[model samples]
Target: MPRASRLAAQLQDEYQAEVSLEKGRGGVFDVWLNDQLVFSKHSVSRFPEDGEIQSAVNAHLAAN
Candidate 1:
């Protein structure tokens, strides 16, 4: 598993949004947020992917 996938799994336990990684065309990976499109980039760019996920998680936490 990639670092981003590992971290996202951890985040999911504390947040309401669902997280998953989908292997995409040209070996790219996509980060899905609440079943919506969010971050789609190379698997190597995990930090930015995590950051984007964190933003959505934080927003959901804030609203509740």
Candidate 2:
């Protein structure tokens, strides 16, 4: 599955505008912020402080 479909619901729960992932030729999971389509291979898989995936979800919400 692509990051967009997987993360869209999570992003929606926290009131993010919109997000989608673009798979590069190398098959990296890039994180996109809004339709402007910024790319990152950082694999936003963990943020340990808050102890729940929703916390990490909310942090990204606050970010954008």
Q: Estimate the TM-score of every prediction.
A: 0.47, 0.38
> Which parts of model 1 have CA positions greater than 4 angstroms off?
16-25, 42-50, 57-64
Assess each prediction's global lDDT (C-alpha) against the native. 0.59, 0.48
Worst 10 residues of 2 by lDDT: 45-54
Pairs that collide in candidate 2 are none
Instruction: Count clashing residue pairs per candidate.
Output: 0, 0
Best by TM-score: 1
Tell me each candidate's RMSD, in Å, in order: 4.3, 5.5
Query: Model 1 Cα displacement at 17 (Å)?
Result: 5.1
lDDT of 1 by residue, 1-64 (tens): 4766676677777674466555555655565655564555564454454366667657755765
Quick one: best lDDT, which candidate?
Answer: 1
Whole-structure CA lDDT of model 2: 0.48
